[model samples]
Target: MTHYFSWLKNPDNRLKLLILAFVITLFPFVAVSFFAFPTTDDYCHTLAVKEMGYWGYQVHYWKTWSGRYIGTLISATQPLAYDSYLGYKLAPIVLILLYVHASLKFAGAITGDKLAKWQTYLLAFLLVFVLIAELPVVSGYFYWYTGYYYTVADIGTLYLLAYLFRNYSKLSSRNIVVLALGIILLVGMNEYTLVWLVVLSGALFFFGSVVTRKLQVKYLVLSAVALVFGVLSVTAPGNAARAESGLYPTPLKYNLLFSIKNSLAWQIHNFAKIAPALCVLALVLIPIACQLFKNKGDFKFLRAHPALSILVFVGCLYLSYFPSYWSIAEPPNLRGQCVITFWTLIGWTYNVFVLTFWALEKGYMKPVEPGKPVAWVVGLYFFFLFTGNFNYRSAWSDLLTGRAARFNKEMHERTALVLNTREEQVYVPKLKNVPYTILIVNDETDPAWASVEVNNGCAEWFFKKKFFYK
Candidate 1:
């Protein structure tokens, strides 16, 4: 691994290094997802798809009308939605690849020289770090459809922004179509993503126009269409229905100010969990990105004026979660955390890039000094900080995998019992660890167990019967 990283640092090699790093980072995510068994929400998502043929048009329309979560309903009813977790997960993996591809090209476009292979690898490192640090339940982000759409799919949309930024110059038919579709899908992912995407997209359009001294008509049109789709995404009739149908009570007035006010404390608390990582990223990644100081005085630019960097970073930190607190009724959930964390990463990256360019444009930077100990210290710090928080081995045990194993064993017994008797109530041990915050199974009110069978892959797999904690 040391040799590989050393070779990449040479800056002459093409981006082949990123492919290797990408695959390595992807391995455990795939492994955990592959073995991931369907949980409570997974069952409901499968049932939505299974029951699609049964729900009349009016009923479907009514459901969609009440709840504006078109993305959720669309993903829920997908034929491949609850297929092997690996298959369902391919979408986000492909998005990550697109991010790497586009980000490299975009950086190249900015500097008039293609980004070095190692830089791309650094981005891959940051992406994985963002994923592990911000997730409330790692498996749900990759494995469960509801969480997958809100978290992975939404983050994928954010990555696609890089692709758009890279290719926005072209007026090709393919680019137009892809951009439009991406906007709609992004809006569909959830409202928080919708708000942030629109803001970022609009800002990018404004900056591109100002920098080039020419209107980017394509991007302007793209931003306008994105805004339209965003409105449609949130106001979907189904959203209202879903909101009413949900067990949680809606506020009498739905005050936007109240939601924003109430969510600050929680979002602030969420930042506390990963502030160290964010600080490390702000300090280390910015200089590397600027390329002004490569060795001993690599951090001299930052060290010269520590307060300015902190002020800017603190601003980025607030802006990261600014759009997140608009839920208006309650605190944003885990998936909301996913969106906020992603935007935070994007905000940090964007801020660093801006800082680098400003420093270069104003000549407020130091000369590069080669063969310095500082580089080694920075490298060690990167390794230490990243390795400290991210633990794939620990994820296997902490994420309810053992409970899944136990759940599998109980299934064997449950199946045999059904074969021998027509019992109405099937007593089973309660699952101690459910992914996310949901109960393992809502047996008290939902007696049919039909949803369970669907998550198990249809009724024949396990006869329909009530299940309860022993």
Candidate 2:
């Protein structure tokens, strides 16, 4: 057992290392998609997709619609309309990959060459943190299609912004252009990318810490350009109407804070649970604190590193506030915003703590190797649990309930019944299968399957010739 543990600690143990990394990367995804979670707003997005037909259409129409310009594009371009369950199902996967890519690259850039082998291990740990933080977001997607779109759009934009900043020194003209294109893609994700623009503009203050004055000016300029494009991308007449459909409600003070607290607490609790080893590591920090201050004066570069880290942490914290308001008044996308916020801070904190320990060991910071053992012990503990648990069916059951089963059965039966009805158009009140409008939009493929839902507590329907149910 001791030999096995020692082997993992060695950098040369590449196979075990690779396996652990792979498991951590893939495990949460297995649990997320298989449950087939669906929220109420998903029907709305599906219906919206059924209405729009291309990226251009979303861009054109969403200018007026305030909600999700990017999603409108995805919905428009999808060939199947509401029938493209496959595209809808894969949405989270696509966003998750983009997120992981941006986060890892950003962390690497910030830490630079000073990041040790053990600290490099923190990258994989950070991935695990992203997953655990993302659980509620994933769960939210199972019910509301629109929620999925909104959450992904917000997190994805924030990550892209961080990735750009972290790699500012290395960014070429090509990268900047690519970042510009990425911003356009974010248009299809949601209009709330606008919120990201606001948060990132505020982050300019932190840029001076890590970037030269010349480059900092350039970044602020590019951010302004992206902000203009983001706003314009959602300015179409049709989209404006739809977007205005969702407005900032008069927020109750308690509701806003409560929602934010719940979102934060969920992530923090999971962080403690899924990464119990981290708790142990936290406890051993008391003695390690003495060693951290010892390195306080020797390495001047260390001074910049902590300052940069604190900047990143504070920026993420402030950005978190806007998402809270949106979650309360509009679509309630706390899950994605919460994950992004929690992990941003955790990643920075992990780096700071690890560096403190490493510095202490080298007599640059402190005189203790006490926290070193704690870190190793905790890392190994996480590796075991993360690899061993593949089937979290119980967790899925708790989150998704029997909704998937019920939705499938009901949808199937309802479709068959709708086919046999004599009415040329049918309005199914409380019908939840692919929203009746999606079926009507694809009337050429299945002419017998037209349906629509009741609007605003009024169960009324207008057929080809007349109105019923006034």
Best by TM-score: 1
Q: Which runs in model 1 stand beyond 4 Å of their true positions? A: 1-26, 54-70, 77-113, 168-174, 205-216, 250-253, 292-328, 367-374, 390-393, 396-421, 432-464
lDDT of 1 at 183: 76
How high a TM-score does candidate 2 get?
A: 0.61
Give Cα distance to truth, residue 264, candidate 2, Å: 12
Show where candidate 2 strays beyond 4 Å: 9-28, 31-39, 55-64, 75-82, 89-122, 141-145, 148-167, 183-198, 205-215, 230-312, 322-332, 339-364, 367-372, 376-470
lDDT of 1 by residue, 1-470 (tens): 89976885666553565465556545555443433444444545465555564244325744564223445554555333444434443544554455455545544433223335566555555656555655565544555554555664454565565555455445577887787777777666666667766765565467557767999777687788778877776576766665665544566325666655555666578778766666766665566555633321322222223334445445444444543344325556666666677666665665565566556656787433323465576557655654554444444443345543444345445556655667665565444443322112344422222343333333322235555544
Root-mean-square deviation per candidate: 6.8, 8.4
lDDT tens readout by residue for model 2, 1-470: 99977886776574456546655555445434433333233444444444453454555544555445556544444323445556544655665555556555544544443444444445544444535433443344332344555556545654665566455556677776767677666754654445455445435534652464454655555576666765665454654364335444454422766656654554454445545444443444424344445544433323434455555554444444444443443323444454444444444444455556455656684355545566677657655544453323333343256434454455555445445556754544343433211111123222112223323211111112111221
Q: Candidates' TM-scores?
A: 0.72, 0.61
lDDT of 2 at 180: 66
Span of ten consecutive residues with least summed lDDT in model 2: 458-467
Tell me how many residue pairs clash in candidate 1. Answer: 17
* Worst window of 10 by summed lDDT in candidate 1: 295-304
